[model samples]
Target: MPTGSGANQATFAGELSVDGSTVSIRRDTDVASERVSVSLPAVVSVTDQTGEARYPAFKAIMGAKKKPIQTMSLADLGVDAAQVGWSGASSKVVDVSPTPARTAGTIVNDDGTGAAQLADFLAGRGFI
Candidate 1:
């Protein structure tokens, strides 16, 4: 992961490591790159920095077209129809409202004192 927003929410069910037998996760940091390995039968959620996915070759695509695909319904998976579909949802949304409009911002012109004005604005907003 590239340490982007919400990156800290990434988690795993098993022990995370730099090297292991089955699976591994690679992430980029501010100072260095990291590699985390996990045992077999593990689930990994990666970020966008993992790498560019390679396009499937034409032959592979053709082969995939010839493969048989099995489609199953919830009942086929031993699940009740009313317990998994939208009709069986536990909660309902009664109403929705639009977000409030934002107020106009303070614009500072470059008059040799722009830096000071910006510092003051940030301080007033408790950002500094």
Candidate 2:
């Protein structure tokens, strides 16, 4: 995002310790890293770096198995079903089409003009 890594974000956010309802999330990219603060009631995805996961014991598993499973719906959660998928999303796939078939690439022969030809090819493709 804006820092280099989660380590950088953590270092910036004081080990990600939040003082209020807002929580800091680590957003990272190759060129940058960022510390983003999301308020309560927001959707968030956490990583193992955030905290350690406690394994369930056999007794806990048996107790969970005995408990009746509760089924919940998006409606019950005050969420519309359509709002979660691609259709009602803020971003959408405007169009999609099958990929064009691959064609044979131009070859550069060991001729004196090979360098010039390669340069022209690269320049034509905006790769120069």
Candidate 3:
């Protein structure tokens, strides 16, 4: 990936989940997603199987709180010398958008009669 100043680049390979609107990233196998509303116990039990470097990982996590992150010019990091930016990156955004709005309406519950009411409501809009 092309690296440069003003570039917001972060590298992470781990399981993640979203609880409602909050996202939780786990370095272990306990992955969860509100979109799916489920936990992958089998997946969580397999993080050790990868057998990746652990010491560097420990240092990285520990360094986050104590280390003084220095802000330097791109030339100091050799990025400016290489002139890496969007021009150097392999990917470019062509277009972007948000998901379309839901066309369905809420179903009002009238106790045990909610089923028939729901059907009638949807049929009124030809949604059935």
Candidate 4:
């Protein structure tokens, strides 16, 4: 399961339904959340807003630790080496460049005209 940004990315990847099933995100000027019931055999991504995590019990944890770890290669999984890893990757990085520096922002000091200046700034930015 994924959440928040992960959920959004999964939606873009077509892995999960757009906006998810259990957790739906509605965005206008800001983001809003809602509960939606979807069919089974579907992917559901959650967000921090959902709830806290429930840690496994000591017995379950001990059992998990006792479980054997199995490692397999692409050949063992019936996958071709050429069909996986960087060699099989569909995309290639042609070049890399540093990000452009950001311009300085207006600083609003708490002067008597600060409120007016802020309003003007907001209006100019279409955020008013």
Candidate 5:
């Protein structure tokens, strides 16, 4: 399985691999987490929280030690290195501030009267 986790939170992306007998799920790892590889045997069904049965064959390939995972540089993949990562990311956030609190509005006392008031307000604003 493939998972991403840290000190305060974790999120599972999906399973890394599964064979007929075993399944590998991804999970978030903390700084102290260890990497492990295990073997699993013949296929079966996998169900998620929504009660949907997953077709094993349609699942993605699981990660394994036997197969080497190659890490290639962006230039190696035919992408310009200068246009990747921090250099390529658009829109930098300079600062963030909390929004001002809003004041309370007058409450409608009558349902029938409120409907007409609402319609007039919306109409004046060109919303209706």
Candidate 6:
């Protein structure tokens, strides 16, 4: 995710739908948003914006202690540790700096010559 979602709803879960044996995840793009469905028993990941977090009640917290806990490792999941760690990464970020300030945009005055001004502006920017 070198160039990440970048302030946009790159991977927003606009909505989620689940059934006994299937799941739905939202996919959004510049053109449209889509719902992708897959069979159940799958691995899924979502960002913080997926939904609001809820604190576990004291009773629920107590009950969790009585429940069985299952744990899996990278090998169990068929993922190689080296593939996901910085030690095996192909690139490292060496530095970060503040972005340069943007220049002010030109103002167009609408008068008898407004259209001509617009054409000139577009041509100057190679947009025409």
Query: Which model scores highest in TM-score?
Result: 1
Candidate 2: give the clashing pairs.
1-28, 1-29, 2-32, 2-33, 3-32, 3-33, 3-34
**Whole-model lDDT values for every prediction:** 0.67, 0.67, 0.53, 0.59, 0.53, 0.74
Per-residue lDDT, model 2, residue 69, is 82
Model 5 misplaced regions, further than 4 Å: 1-72, 111-128
Point out the higher-scoring one by lDDT: 5 or 6. 6
Higher lDDT: candidate 2 or 3? 2
Query: How do the residues 44-116 of candidate 3 rate in per-residue lDDT, one tens digit apiece?
Result: 2223433575556777888788978889887786665445777677778899999998797674758998889
Question: Runs in model 3 with CA error above 4 Å?
Answer: 1-71, 115-128
**RMSD (Å) of each candidate, 1 decimal:** 8.4, 9.8, 13.9, 8.5, 16.9, 9.4
Model 2: residues with Cα > 4 Å off, grouped in runs: 1-17, 72-128
- Write out the backbone clash pairs for model 4: none
Compose the digit string of candidate 4's lDDT tens values, residues 1-128: 53432332212211223443343332222363333444333454444543567999999998999899999987787888898889899999999999999999889678799999999988998998
TM-score of candidate 3 versus the correct structure, residues matched by position: 0.33
TM-score of every candidate = 0.53, 0.41, 0.33, 0.48, 0.29, 0.43
Tens-digit per-residue lDDT, 1-128, candidate 2: 22332222223332254548776766565688777875654445555565667999999998998998889988898878788977678986789999999999977686799889989998999999
Among residues 3 or more apart in sequence or in different chains, the pairs in candidate 1 whose N, CA or C atoms overlap within 3 Å are 1-27, 17-37
How does model 4 fare in lDDT? 0.59
Better of 2 and 4 by lDDT: 2
Better of 5 and 6 by TM-score: 6
| Tens digit per residue, CA lDDT, model 5, 28-126 | 445533223344432322224224565544233443435677898766778886787789888788999999999986567776788888888789889
Error of 1 at 97 (Å): 2.3
> Candidate 1: misplaced stretches above 4 Å?
1-21, 26-37, 55-69, 120-128
Give the local distance difference test score of model 6.
0.74
